[model samples]
Target chain A: MTVMTTAPDKRDNAPILSVRDLKVHFPIPGKGLFAKDRPLKAVDGVDFDLYPGETLGVVGESGCGKSTLGRAILQLIAPSGGQVAWLGKNIVGIPHRDMQPLRRDLQIIFQDPLASLNPRMTIGEIIAEPLVTHKPELGKDEIKTRVKRMMARVGLLPQMINRYPHEFSGGQCQRIGIARAMILEPKLIVCDEPVSALDVSIQAQIVNLLQELQREFDLSLIFISHDLSIVRHICHRIMVLYLGNVMELADRDSIYANPKHPYTKALISAVPIPDPEIERNKERIVLTGDLPSPLSPPSGCVFRTRCPFAQEKCATDVPTIDRVSETQEVACHFHNSI
Target chain B: MMNKSEKTALLQSASAAKEIEGRSLWRDARIRLFRNKAAVGSMIILGIITLLAIIAPLLSPYAYDQIDWGYIQEGPNWENGHIFGTDGNGRDLFIRVLYGARVSLAVGLLATAVSLIIGVTYGAIAGYFGGKIDSIMMRFVDVLYSLPFMFFVIMLMVVFGRNIFLIFVALGAVEWLTMARIVRGQTLSLRRREFIEAAHATGVSNFKIIFRHVIPNVLGPVIVYMTLTIPQVILTESFLSFLGLGVQEPLTSWGVLISEGAKVIEASTWMLIYPAVFLALTLFCFNFIGDGLRDALDPKDR
Candidate 1:
C-alpha cells in the first residue's frame, strides 16, 4: 500500500486539552464476604492530545471504552489515574466547586440527545441552562435572546424554543443537543457519538452541521464514535482504541490508507467501499472471537486473542506505541512484517 | 407556477402551521384529568364537601352542640328543620357531619403536607447522594419501619396530651417514612438519568438538579401518593378519635361522631348512617381522584 502524506507538522503549539495515561477502573463488588474486590479496567492507560480547531475521532468497538474515554477527558467521570490538563491546568480530582468555572470553556454533547436533555425543561431552558450556571450575571432577556439565536442557528425555529424534548424528532433533538453544547461557545467539545443515534439521512445533516459549527466557532472537538465512515469524513486525526488501549493514532488519510496495526488494518478493511467494483475486489479481514471481558483482558496485548497475526512475542511482551511516521504511531510488534 | 423563494416561503408557512401550540406536561396532565369522568365527578364531590365544611354553620339552623329536647332522636324531619335527624346529643346530625368534614379534611391535608415536605427532602438527599449516605439513610428508614406505628402514635398522644395539632404532627412524622422510601426510590432511578449527568456537566448545582430536575420528574408518583395519603391520615385520625384519644368536645370529627353514633345504633340508626356515609363518600372521592391523577400524570398513559 502506498503511504499518503499530508501537511507539514504544526503541533508545536500547545494543545487545548492534553490527556496523559488516563485510567478509569471501576471496582467490582466481592461475591462472598471475604472475596477480594476486582477492578474492571474500563479505560486503562490512554493518552491523546486535542488541539484547537481540530476534530480528533476516537473510534472502537462497543466494549472498547471509547465513551468512558470521552467522559474521562471532560472530568465527568474522575479518572483512576492520569493527568487531564485543560489549558495547561491539571483538572483531575479538583473539587466540583472549583471546576464549575472551568466548565464554561469545556462542554460535552451526548449520544442520546433526548436522554441528555431534561424532559421537564423546555428547549429554551435546556439550551440556556449552561448560561444560567456559568453566566449568572446575564439577565433573563439576554439569555432568552441568545437561546433563540442558538435555536435558529441549529436549524430549529425560534418559536419552537418552548417545545419539550419529546415533542421534537430524533434529528431535531440532536440539533437541540448541539445548540445546548455550543450555547456556551466552549473551546473544546467532547461529542460522545453525537450522530450515532440519529437516522442515516439525519446523521449526515448533523455531521455537516457539526463541521459547519466547528469551522464557524473555530472549536476543537473530540468526536467519539463507533462508525468508521463518519469518523473518516469529519476527523483530521483518528485514534483507534481496543479494550481501553490506544492501538494506533495517526492522521485520517494515513490511518485509512496505510494502517500499521493489525487491529486497525482489520477495522479499515471492514468498512465496505462505496464503489461496487472496488468493494468486490477488496480483501476483508474478519477477526475471530468475541471481545474478552474487561475484568480479565488478555495479557501482554489485549487484542492478541482476536488478532489474526498473533505470535509468541505478542503474548509474552506488550508493544508500546512506536513512531512509524511523522504523523502516525502504531502499537504492534510486527507492523512492517504485517 | 411558484418561484424558488415563494416556494420556500410557502414551505416555511406550511411547517409553521404544522407546529402545534406548545403545551406543558402539567397542562397536558390537567386536560387528561378533566377528560376522566370519574376524576371530574370526584373533584366535584370534593369541592362540594370542602364548601360544606367551610359553611357548616350557615348550612344548618341548629348549632352542632345544640340540645333540641322537643325533637330528640327525630329522623329526617326536613319540614321541622332537623334534616338528617338528631344525634344522641339531640344536635342536628347534618350540621355535625358538615363540621366533621372540616376536622377530617384538615387532618388529611395538613398531615400530608408535613409528610410531603419531610419525605421529599429526606428522600431526595438520600437518593441523589447515594452509596454510604444512601445506605445509612435507607437503613434508618428500615429501622423506623420496624417500629410499631400505632404504638408510636399512641405514645405520642399520651405524651402530647391528644391535642389536634399533636395528631397532625404525629401522623405526619409516621406517614413520612413511606413517602421518604417512595421518593428515594424515584430519586435513585432519576439520579442516574442522562439529564442529571447533563446538568452535572453544565455545572448546575447539586441542589438545583435535585429540586428542579429530579423532584419535578418524580412528582407524578409523589402527587398520586399525596392524594392516597390524605385518606390514610383521615382514617388514622378517625381511628384515634374512635378510641376517644382525638378531638375533645365542641370540635367533633367524623371518627368522634361515628363512635358516638355507634353507641346509640339500636335506638337511632340515622346517627351512624349519616356520619358513616359522609366519611365513606369523601374517602371514595379522594381515592378516585388519586387514581385519575396517577393515570393522567403517567407517561406510559400518554
Candidate 2:
C-alpha cells in the first residue's frame, strides 16, 4: 500500500528521502538602515532520514527551524545550503518552473485551514484547480468528475461542491485539504501541524483520518508539530529540533522511554500526565528563559544557554550528531551524562 | 435602544434562525448596494448619459467641425437643423456636445484600463516578494510619487505630439504609478496569509500565486481605484482638450466643447449650462459607482 511496498526493509532500511547539512537563512536588518547581506539561519545543518510508509515527526518550539526544515525539503522555501535528496533527486535551489513536476510528487498540508483554501473559489474549484493547472491535457469533464469524487471521498456533500471556503467548518476545511493532497496521489506529504488549528475533538478525528488515509493511500509523511504526545502517537521516528538544529533523533518509544539529549528530556518531561497521581509523581523538567535569536545563534551548541548540561565544551566547538547506538543520534557533549 | 424583553426576543429569533445557507456574498452585497437610493439614482443618471453618448453621432445632422456662415452665432430653433443652437463660429453646439461623449468615454475607459493593468501588476510583485525587492521598488515609486500629477502629465503632453492615442497612453502610464503603489501594499499583506504559502508549498509558481491567490483578494481595492481613475481621466482629457493640447477640433471632447462654450458665455447661457451639467453628472456617476463598489467589496459591510 505504501510508495515502496515492493521492498520490506523500510524504516531500518534504505532512505527514500535523505536530508544532509540542510541550512535555510533569512537576512535580517542589521546596523545599516538599508543593509542587504546578512540573514538569520532558520534551519542550520539539520540531518534526517525518512523511509517508505513511515511518519517522521519533527517536534520543536516555534522558530526552532522545524517548519523551515520541512519547507526546505519540499523546496517551498529555498535552502541556503546542503542537500535534500527526495527519491534520489536533489531538489535544492531548484527553479520554480522545474519544481512544478516535482510538486506533484510531494505536497504540504498547511497549519491554518481557513487561510489555506481560496475564499473566492468554490470547494470543487479549489481542489480541481491544481489538477487542471498541472495536467492541462486532462479534459474539463474529467476534472469535474474527479473533483466530485474527491469531495465525496473527503466526506463533503455533493451539493456542497459549489460552496466557498467560508461556508465550511474548520474540520471540513481540513478534510478538503486532505482531499486536495491525495487527489494527485503524492509520494510524500509534509504536514505543517495539520491538527494544531482544529478543536480537541476535531484533532482526534483528523488524526484518525490521516492514519486511515495513510493506510488507504500509502503516503510517506513528514509530520511537523509542537505537541509531543500527538507526535508520539503518529510518528514511527521522531526528531527533536532546537534553534535550527536537530537535538535528538530516534524511534518514538526509544526517544520517549530513554530521552538522550537534555533538550529532548526537557520537552518530554513537560508533557502533563493525564493521571493526577502519576502527574504529581513525575518531576517537571523546565528549561531556562526564551529561545535565542536564530540570526545570532550561540557559538557551540545552539541550546547551550538554556541547556542545564552545559559545560566549558558546550560553549566552544559545536557537537555533531554522534551515534550513541545503532538506532539513536544525539548532538550534545554531555548527552550520555544528562 | 430596545426594551430588555424585546432585545432578548430579537436575539432569540436571530439565534434560532442562524441558517447561513443558499446565500452568496456577491448577491448580498448587490442587495445592500441596490437599497442605497443615491447609488441607484446615479445608476439611472449614468444609464441616460451612456445612451446619449452612444447615439450622439446618429441624432446630430450637422458635422461637428463644419463651419457655416449662414448659421453663424445662431440660437436654438428648427432653422438650419441647429437643434441645440449654434456656437460662436456657427457650429452646432448639440452636434459637438454629442460627439464629445465618445471622446470622454474613450479617454476614461482606455486610460483607466492601462493604468490599472500596470499598477496592479507592479504592486502585486513588489508586495508579494517583500524584503529587499519590496523596499527598492517602493522607493522608486516614492520618488516619482512626490511629483505633482498635473505637472508631470502636462510635461508629457509638451513632449509628445497631440495625438489621441498618445495622450491616452501617456495619461495611463503616469496614473498607473499610483495604482502599482497601492497594489504592492495589498500584495505584501496578502503574502503573509497561509494560502500564499500553501500555494508556494504546492509548487505553484510565483506568477500563478500572484494571479490566482493575491490578485483575486486584492481586486476590491483595484476595482475601486479603477472606478475613481475613470472620472479623473475624463477630467484630465477635458482639461488638456480645453487647452487645445488634447482632442482636436474635428474630433471634439467635453473639454473642447466646454472651452468653446465658455468663450461665448456672455451671449449664450445654454452652451455653458448644458456641457457643465453633463460633465458634472458624468463625474458624479463615476463617484457614486466607486462608492458602491467600496461598500460592495467590503466584507464587514455584511
Please report the candidate that would top DockQ against the real structure. 1
Q: Which has the greatest lDDT?
A: 1
Error of 2 at A241 (Å): 1.1
Per-candidate TM-scores read 0.95, 0.87
Per-residue lDDT for B1-302 in model 2, tens only?
35547755554455454223445556666887797777889889988888877887687777788887787777788766887888888788887877788889889999999998888988899998888998998898888878886676677777875678878887897788989988988887888787777677666778888998899889878888898999999998888878788886678888988888898898887788777878899899989988987887785754
DockQ of candidate 2 against the true complex: 0.24
User: How much TM-score does chain B earn in each model?
Assistant: 0.91, 0.85
Could you give candidate 1's per-residue lDDT for residues B1-302 as a string of tens digits?
Answer: 45547755654564455334567788889999999999999999999999999988988888988989988888989798998998766778899889899999999999999999999999999999999999999999999889997788789877878688988988998899999999999999988788888888888998999888999898989999999999999999999999988898888999999998899899889899998999999999999999999999995964
Complex DockQ per candidate: 0.50, 0.24
Query: What does candidate 2's lDDT look like per residue over A197-294, in tens digits?
Result: 99888887788778767777777899999988788878888899998898999888789899999999999999988999999999878987999988
lDDT of each: 0.89, 0.82
What local lDDT does model 1 show for residue A290?
Answer: 89
Instruction: Give stretches of model 2 more than 4 Å off.
Output: A1-12, A33-36, A94-98, B1-31, B58-85, B125-161
Superposed by TM-score, candidate 1 places the C-alpha of residue B2 at a distance from the truth, in angstroms, of 16
Docking class of predicted structure 2: acceptable
